[model samples]
Target: MASFAVLLRAVNIGPGLRVSSADLRGAADDAGLADARTLLNSGNLVVTPGSSGAGSAADVARLVEERLAERVGQDVSAVGLSAEQLDAIAAANPFPAAARDDPSHLQVHVPFGDLDEAGIARLDLASPGREMLATAAGVLYVHYVDGIGRSKLTPKVIDRAVGAPTTARNWNTITKLRAACAGLASR
Candidate 1:
């Protein structure tokens, strides 16, 4: 069995799409994923496909989405990454200083599709702060130099700029998810 880090998009961020961590874990378990664990209420999950026959990360994501839809009565998009992929994303931290000094200001954006360069350029043009942006391994790393709350780089701006929906996790969350993936892989 291979472990995967599954990220659910746009859940628990607003009033209409609230899903508890327990519910998320139950959904994964019902989806035939083993060792299901949730990192936060924001829908970060780590699990292994036991007898689910999910051959790839994409398949795992699909299964999770289906289960979550059934449980929550609405569609929930998920992006899955294999253990190696998660580790690679963590290792590819472009803003190491930000991650070390101000982890909350460092965000890793995981897009549903490949990031568009033109859109990223548009985003760069729209940036109002000293935010640094980089893309590696199909993920975007952003360092909010001035802090995220006051920044104008909102979710809508990012979605418009990247031409794809993305879910962001701070450096602390990313590292925790990486460690969870490592633990799941070792089991």
Candidate 2:
């Protein structure tokens, strides 16, 4: 069974749609995913396909989304990446200094669809702070030099600029999730 990281978009950000980590694990279990684990309450899940076995990361994502929708009664979009993909993302980090010195300021945005160059250009033009953007392997790496809270690079702006729905995890969280995926693979 291959390991995968399933990232749910826009969850637990408000009172409207709140999905607990336990509920996420339960959804994965119900979906026949084995060794399901969740990191933080922001919908980061690591799991392996059960005895039935799933096809690609997309297949795993669909199964999890279906089960989670059944449990939560809301459609939560998920982006799944294989263990190797997660490792590649980590390896593709362009702002290593930011990740090491100010990990919280570094964010990795995983897009659900293809990233548009025009949208990326728009994002660069819209940046009013000392934010830096880089793209590698279809993933966007952003370093909020002025910190995220004060920055104008909100989720809406990112989604609109990238022309795709995306979920972002800080550098710290990315490392943790990568470790979780590695652990699942080793077992």
Candidate 3:
């Protein structure tokens, strides 16, 4: 069995993408994922694929999206990370100091694929002061020294610049994900 950290996009924030943890767990069980559990209301799930119909990381992500559509009546999408990948992502934190000292100001922008240097440059220019952007390990760590609210590095800018599906997690969430998926690495 393989463990995966599944991150669903746009969930539980408002009326448009409402979903409960119980509903998510039920749908995951139906999709042949064992030990399915959610981390928070934002749709962070960790599941181990059962001994049947298991496939690659992308395949499981598709399965989750499909099962969510079928059972939850919502076409929820997500990003999947293997245990090892999660390890790399956490280890590659360029702003460890910020993560420790000012966690709320640190944001990790995990893109589906690698982002070019030009995009990173653009993102750097977007912030006028007290902002740092580090592009590493298929992720971008944005350090907003003045807090995210004051920065103009919006998700729209990230998506347009990276030209891919990207979901961001704060330092707190990233650490939580690492802790939540630690069991997979130990196995």
lDDT of 1 by residue, 79-175 (tens): 9999888888878888889989999999998889888877887788777688898888788888999988888888888887888999999999988
* Order of quality (TM-score): 2, 1, 3
TM-score of 2: 0.95
> Candidate 3: misplaced stretches above 4 Å?
184-187
- Give the deviation of candidate 3 from the true structure as CA RMSD: 1.9
Task: Looking at model 3, report the run of 10 residues with the lowest lDDT sum.
Answer: 51-60
Q: Tens digit of lDDT per residue, candidate 3, span 131-171? A: 88888777788888988876777778777777676888888
* Poorest stretch of ten by lDDT in candidate 1: 120-129
lDDT (Cα atoms) of all candidates against the true structure? 0.87, 0.89, 0.78
In terms of lDDT, the best-performing candidate is 2
